[model samples]
Target: MSYVLAGDVGGTKTVLCLYQVADDNSVGGSMEEIYKAVYPSAGHERFSDLITAFLAEVTQRPERACFGIAGPIQDQCCTATNLPWVIDARQLAEEFGFADVYLLNDLEATAHGMLHLSADEFVELNPQAMPQAGHAAVIAAGTGLGQAIMAWDGQRHIVMPTEGGHCDFGPNTRQEDALLLFLRERFGGHVSGERILAGDGFGNLYDFLRTSGFAAPNPAIEAEMANEDRNAVISHHGLAGDDPLCTEAMRLFVRIYGSEAGNLALKCLPRGGIYIGGGIGPKIRAALESGVFMQGFLDKGRMARAIEHVPVRLSLNPEAPLLGAAHMALLRSQG
Candidate 1:
């Protein structure tokens, strides 16, 4: 029996899946699952430890494996952005006796996964505009902001990885200018767009508003923020409209998200479409649909009309990266 392993490696958690493909190796053949599990990345000191544990749970070995990791990938290796771990495809192959292995930047894998998604997998943020055939762009905010470009080569989609998220955060208003200054003081250096647009960005914006004396922090929300994931807590209260401060923060967050998404649209001129992936997009679909996101998106000044025509979509499938890694593993096994 031949099997392949696929994984989605993140800062907070790691997921591993083992799949057994049919003997014919047809893409449509039954790809039975052998095993699947999730592990807390912080619980293990090394990725090797986590991988070994996954293998221990299964009796059989996989012919090949691929990992979608959150970081820049080079030469089949990647050093995780938020986690202190270095993953090398060569090391994994040598140690596990796998026929082959691949390491892909998480966003690249997510972009690859886009090709296999159905219409139901996407939530239309702008259905008014029809999708025209051209280039496409993907922007995601999670542990960090990730960007990718997709081009149709007259056949399949080719994904090009980029670190555009690390680009400087351009504040469109005086408030954002102040927020940038605040983040500068907090980080003591260059503040990238990710500083205000990723998972930690929620807390950063909230803290800036409070510290800048623009808003008073609610004691109840403050307490909850301390006890739980600050960003999640803020997002919950923001969406609920239960706390004015949280709600304002949420508004600002979506606006920035929208503005950045617009920036992507302008950069690539993606008439094919723009995909908003990552964990945050699907959660705040309500706010996204409320026109606030579009307000910020259309604030593109002269290019506003051009961007307005670009179709924007939210990827509802959080496991797209994992699925893409699995597909890559299948290709590696066949080769």
Candidate 2:
């Protein structure tokens, strides 16, 4: 039996999985999982090296492979956004001896995976949401922000990857106006939405609050920053309301996140809905559920009503990108 390989490549970590395809092309046949592994992305010098190491561990070589990468894809090649590696689909196929290789933007993969998920896997944030048939949007904030659109024809969804997260940051309030100036100066130029909406945004916001006298810095939390992931620590304390500064940081983070989501909705007018996926969304579920998120979402003047009924869903599954890559591989292998 031939094997199919799938991977979810991210800034922090990479997960690879192998599945054994059914020998017969029968209607009831299915692929079975055979192997899976996770690796720290920073530990490997090149993506090719990581692939070589993974292939060494498995006995069977895959005939086809697909990877969901955190970057823009061009001509089936990608220069990873947060990693220092260049990935080319054709080169990997030749080097790894695979019959075919496929690459997708991380959010595009997540959008494909969303189609396969069950209703229970999603938490609806819009009380008045109306699920309908139309185009849809997907936005994720992890190490970086990602955005995609699922253009639904009468038959199926066509995932369109975009670098919308890099768009200019729009301030909705007086405080956010200050935030724009602060980030602009810190970044030494044009500040993108990701500056205040991504994982590291927690630390940025916390620093702003502390320096702005929003609240006195917590000595204990500050000390932990050096030992742990500073962003994660800030988010943890912020979500738990353990420190005033951290709490405000989370509030501001959630606010900006929702505003950006709204911005995506305006661009695509996704009537099917907007699915929020990423490593950070599930962790801060509580903060997202607070009314602050929705308030920020609807804060748009004159255009708020256009997307009020569009469903805003938070996907709880973190392995969606991996699953999507696997399924895409299986489909391509069959064809």
TM-scores vs. true structure, each candidate = 0.92, 0.93
In model 2, the clashing pairs are none
Q: Which has the greatest lDDT?
A: 2
> Per-residue lDDT for 220-258 in model 1, tens only?
889998899999999999999998778888999999989
Off by over 4 Å in 2: 22-31
Q: TM-score of the candidate numbered 2?
A: 0.93
Clashes of each: 0, 0
Global local distance difference test of model 2: 0.89
Error of 1 at 285 (Å): 1.7
Task: Give the Å shift of residue 173 in candidate 2.
Answer: 1.0
In order, candidate lDDTs are 0.87, 0.89
